[model samples]
Target: MPSITINGRPAEFEEGQSILEVALAQEQEIPHYCWHPGLSVVANCRICLAEIWAPNPRNEGKLEPMPKLMPTCQTMAQDGQVVYTDSPKAVANQRSVMELLLINHPVDCPVCDQAGECYLQDYAYRYGRASSRFEEEKIKQPKKDIGEHVLLYGDRCIMCTRCVRFTREVTGTEELMVQGRGATEEIDVFPGKGLDNELSGNVVDLCPVGALLDKDFLFAQRVWFMTKTPSIDGITASGDNISVEHNNGTVFRLKPRPNASINKWWISDEIRYGWKFIHDESRHVMPMLRSRDEWPSPKAAEAWTASMEAATKGLKSDGRLAMMVSPMLSCEDAWHLGQMALSIDPQAVIGVGPVPFNGEDKSFPGGYTVRAEKAPNARGVRRVLSALGIDVLDAVGMEKALSSNTSIDRVILTGNYPSEWVTPSFADAVGQERFLLLIDTLPNSLTSRADVFLPGATWMEKAGTFENVDGILQSFEQAIEPVDYCKSEAQIAMDLQSALSGQKPTVFNAAATRQAMASQAALDRFVSDVTLPKVPQTVESDMSIIEL
Candidate 1:
């Protein structure tokens, strides 16, 4: 294999990779801007300039130095090449470039939303001069409301052109472009058009500085104070890897985690802003039971215990019970629910709940997609039912069965959808005569008819696996605690199972549940094929503080 020497360190490289790419791959520091792996290379940011020495075959393979410093982002790596990013000449270029880029940058890090994560601040501190050399007044640009989800702080932009290129090449909207030349240059939208593309929120993530900001996330919380948890896209079947940034149990934003085979480096605005429903005030937060007259009984510990006992009482293998597992639940949750139902009655009817759809799947020029199927785990729920040797039914099939099967006197239904999913026809199919036990996160028409209503948790409050549209099994960790008095669907299932057996309920562990599922011959893939999220390592600072 061919290798290149970067800053005296030898590293192997593949053909056609840039010198900057090699440096990054080898953990060598090379300050850069205007160059993103997902965007085109403009080579406008000159901070990555490096001195290069390569072998010359014409001169008997002697090493010859390039005449001037080269842009590492555009310079392809060559075998037997020697690169210097820490030499006198390269360091001087870096200082000059950093100083130039910071000339017009505002001194607003104290108030900027990107203060903690801004690349400009980091590079300026490391590669720039201690003080400014310019005496003239700095150029000031006004903030613009460019799109519904994005705001542009023109004064903070260093003209990296990352946002401009994303709109032109990836989204193909061409709404953003450079409006001026030289020091007065600024990014602006077309005269009549706005940056309202379906994926417009991605511009905020692409900006290296605080130029592009998310309107919804602006002034919400500082990046340093938030905890970022790796999670999957719970609203769509695309299963885009995401970092859920939250502070004090409140989610502030969702950023795309780069998965080349899936969502790449971008996520749709729908997924970015769809998490608002998780904190809605109308969420079901407490368990409720219906009295003899069909009115909600007062909340009490005894009432809750009685509701759980009655929900699973009078158990026999009579095939008189039906359980509708929701697609919104995790694969582990679905499996546990299925096992609990089967334990109570061997011939119980198990079917998948309703799967929601909006429009056809939409694709972007950059290969990112938004799935029409809103539910995340429909395929997973179906897989669990199939493994249990039960025939799975769709929404229509479940409705028909509920209406046709006269022996099904007890039904257990789960719904954790973000919106109202109960339709009049489906509601009528369940009817008012039978005992209906509902585990849901939101209120709907069925909540009024349910004999026992248990508040369930959302995906953010649970740790489990979801199978995407492409049959990829991905796992996510819990980002926050469940809302008050709300338990995860898996916990609810476990509690019911324990109540039926007259034993104390144990804590629900998704990993343990998956391991138990893998014990089955037909469901062994849960252990081998599920892809867990990579846990990031934390390195403590070694520098000792000197007290003055």
Candidate 2:
């Protein structure tokens, strides 16, 4: 262990830790812009300048200050070394640096999207003078559309080079570069080239100031008006951690939540822009049922209740039953669905549903990847079925079994896929069953043929744990309420189970359901002594990448 004194306060740190790292760990404030934990430190942002002290050149027993100020982010802490982050000398140097950065910055916080959480605003308040001393005209640079999702406000940039470094080091696209020199310096993309990398949305999150902005969320909402709910992106099997930003029941955007073990400081464009489906107008919001005449029944509570009763009758039969567990569901929801199937018929066939696989895994230079497997919980679904001693089947296997086995009269299918996954052949084959019940979040090719359709909630509307491809189970909380009249899978499952038991069904309690699932033998592996890292706080800070 090594120790150092920062601003008259003793702080302990590791041997190779820097003064900025020690200060931030102790909740001490040290203004910075160019340094990021996930990127190489260039020390271009001189805002973190601090006075350093070491053993005197003439006398080894005495301490003396270094003649020049050093960047705290690049300077490693030594035993007995004394550093001053806010001393008179350090403050004077930082204020001068801040003044230089603001000489060209426009005073337009009212129209800026990053006004509430902008680092430049905070730093200017702390280290800048009340008024600018420069009497010359300010430089004005035109805004440029550098990428499909990124817009650059040249005047707002302080030449921190965070965005340029992100594309070069993390994405390896090299689409961004610094143009011009001195007062005319600005970030620009190569001609005929835009930042279309799979990880391009990360630059917006990496930007400490308002220079880099997301085109999708430009002027959408103020940061202070929205609340962030921690969750994981269900668009891919990676289960990358995320935060859903919404205001007044509307999701404005999705940003990566810093999880050092999983996603680290960046998230792919899929996770960043995949929340649009939540607001799609074509979502299946109301429950529907097919009458004896093969026509959809009119919408009403009676229709919904009648459909539930019909589904219960189908499940409470002596005939063979089949349940298709979707990878889009959490382990807790899948477990409940499987239990209800077996309770009706001990020999019920249970298997995983369709898994969407696109191109091969697209990996970046920084080790971030977008998996080809689009499903979020396939491994989790398999774990549940394996624990229940049920044989897993694919779409082909389930269709073949249903069509050939006359004894398989009842079937339960669920899917929340972003795209159409049910083939016409499979849907037509499953339509032959005596009772066909479909549970889904959106309408698809198979919905029209289902005897009963239950509108299920999306991953954003429910709370549960999902096991990634590597079998790491992580929990996520519900972000927003279910869209329109949709009901959660847990709630629907609970109601159906109660109806089967000849008792009253109550509303779903996610916490209680998760607690009850802890005792299940199938879920024991996921919850047994497995501890996930705590999610970082959602409050925006003066700095984005504090770890150095």
Candidate 3:
């Protein structure tokens, strides 16, 4: 490894690594803009200028500091490289650059959506002069709606060309471009088409200034006011990394949380804007048990116990029990459900629910992909069932087991899909012989026919891990409490098990459950306290790694 001296601190670097990259890896301060790991480096913005030292040609063998500052972003680190980010010359240059960037920037911090988390504000306070030198009229540029979800304020741009490079190099759409040069330079989309790619919202996150904004999250909430919880996107089996940003139990937005092994620095638009369903008011909120002559009470605990009694009353000691666990459930929930079923009948037929699929996997030029499989934890459900010594069945096999064998009398179904998963034909296939129990987050046609309907919790309202498409077990935290009367799938499973054993039902604790199951082969590597990789904030670095 090559070594570089930055601001009097020695740091090792890989071959061909730049000075800016090495400095950031060591958490050293070096102010920069126009450099993002996910995009190409234009080096147009001169904010990262730093003094460089090298052997002088004029002197025989003495080292001399370069008079002209070098852009640290474009300067490769050599074995004996010496870079000074805090030298008198470098400090003066940084201050001057900050002043220049703010010359035309409007003082609209009160109205800016990115005010609290804006890097420009942080750098200006640290490296800029107290007073302005410009007395002339400032340039004013009109804001433009460049895309369906992207809005652009031309004046706030520093011509870093990151957004432009993303469309060209990453998405390969080439929708955005630099329309002008120098003082009049601005970001614009091609005419007759907008920046509406499947991965367009990432530009707002890429912007260091308040130039680009997400239309959906334009004025939702301040960054400081919202609590961020690490989560996995439920849109696809890929399980792209994300952070659920909410305030007072209301989710305001979903943003990418970098995971070097999964999603890296970007996520698809589905992951960015697919959280609206979590807040829908029409979702089922209360557990209910449908008796032959009357309706059960709405009380969660009482209804939970009654539902379990009704569901198990029709079950026989023979292998007559069937369970369909949805792939949307976390591994812990699925495992608990399997355990509850096996406790009732050792040879119970357990299977995964219907998995939704759209078109084939769509691959982008930059190596990002949106998988065709829509479920988040199919691998997880299978792994859980296999660990419990239960032979799993698919939708077809489950139907066959019910239809071919007239002895199968009890059925339990669990799901939290974004769309209609239970069709009329699916209900027709089950026939009228078996009593049905349903656990779901939304109200579908299947709810009306179920003997026991248990309101289930969404992924946002629970904390657990999912084995993604790649079989990597990634954990997510609860963003908010379960909606009115709803209990988590794990909790519901625990309650059901308690009712069978004539024990009082208790709420499930995810951390404790994970610890208990730590010895299982399926969850051998499960970690409950997983967090997103750190987003370096010090400055000066551009290293892109897209693990799509």
Candidate 4:
């Protein structure tokens, strides 16, 4: 093991890891670009340089402690190494490099996509000199129409080359290449085509500067105003965890979050732009009331009970009950729905609803992505169904159960697909049944046809867990308030469960819910005393693991 001192703090590391790796491992701040651990170490940006202190010549063996400026990313840490990430000289060098990069940059942080999280923006605030010294006119370049999906504003480039390298090595698209020389350098797509590659939008994210911007997200909203919520990318079978940041109730942008075990550094464009469907003009907003039934405001339990009682006056508990838990619903919500199903009869048929998809699963750069299975959490729904000992029925079964000849007369369906995921025929089929109860985040055919409709919270407003194809459970936190009077499906299902089972509503708290879930398990497979990971804000450096 190589030992190092970072800013007077003792640290230890593997022999070959760079100083940047050691510093970041210890959570020390160092600006970086073009330094993804998953990719080849280019060390292109000089921003990560640090002062490596060493011994005086006479007392070299004992480390007398004088320092020298070095590229922290390029220097390998060896035994008893010492590094200063905050030396005056090192700090000055970083500032000067930032100034040089800023010389030709356009003054557009106000509208730029790389606002809050931009390394240049962060470095400028911390390491840069107060003002720019350049008197020359800012450089300008034409927005090169790259592919259909990408527009390259080469002038905004910091020359990170992350996109170019990604195209060449990861996607093998080879549609992008650098052209011209030095100051005149520009990015150009191959002639006769735009960025037709599957992994194109990724360039927009890879660009450290606004050199590449999603034409769709450009100027949509000021970055600072948006709130970020962690959610799983619903577009893929791998179920990559993503951040869905929105302004107000409108979804503004998407980005990848680090999930070391699953989606390491990238999420596909399907996961990226799927929110567009959420903004679909006909996307339902308010709760729909059954035509023959009068619905009341449900701000509280009494109002909700009044609403339910008024809507289902003739329906009885013995009526064959069905609850369709959408794959889009979170695991905790699905579990609550499972509880609701058993609460109704303890033998009710709980069917999995429609999973929308076109055809083949699409693979993008770095790995397979955006599965043909359009739904994000089908596996999670199945997990709930299996755990609760309910029959996990699919779309085909749902259709069969809703037919006139079937015993399932009262059915509850939750549909939140961006498009018409549920068929009109299915809606008509369920509608003709004795009772159709609809729960959805957006308006769809089934919601319109149901006898009673319940509003659902969009991904931004809710917190829950999702299980990917491999059975790894990833948790998401709520970032925004519930959209338009809708409560989280978790809250709805729990309330319904409490109504059915005669127990108090037990909302899902990440830590408490796990224990509750374990208690519900009948065997060793579902038993675990494990606790939730520390919330990011509460994590403490002093709590580092103690070796046994």
TM, every model: 0.96, 0.93, 0.91, 0.84
TM-score of 4: 0.84
The CA lDDT of each predicted structure is: 0.89, 0.83, 0.81, 0.70
The sequence of per-residue lDDT tens digits that candidate 2 reaches over residues 1-548 is: 67888888889999878788888989888899999888988999899999999876589558988889999999998878898878888899888988899898997899999998889998889888888998899999999888889999888998999989998998899999999998998899989999888999899988988988999999999998988888887878987888888888789999887777778888888878876877888877778777642224344466568879988877767789888888988887887887777778889887888788889988888878888988999988777767766777876688788778888888889988776778888777676547888999767887877888988888888887788877788878888898776777767877888889988887766556666766776566555634343655766565677677
> Residue-pair clashes per candidate, as listed?
0, 0, 0, 4
After superposing candidate 3 on the true structure, give the runs of residues whose Cα lies further than 4 Å from its correct spot. 55-61, 291-319, 504-507, 521-523, 527-548
Residue 303's C-alpha lDDT in candidate 3?
60
Looking at candidate 3, the ten consecutive residues that score lowest on lDDT are: 528-537
Q: Select the stronger candidate by TM-score from 3 and 4.
A: 3
lDDT of 1 by residue, 438-470 (tens): 999888999979988888989999999999999
lDDT tens digits, residue span 1-96, model 3: 668798889999998777888999987878888887666677877888889886665786467777799999988887666888888988999889
Q: Candidate 1 overall Cα lDDT vs. reference?
A: 0.89
lDDT of residue 540 for candidate 2: 55
Ranking by TM-score: 1, 2, 3, 4
Better of 2 and 3 by lDDT: 2
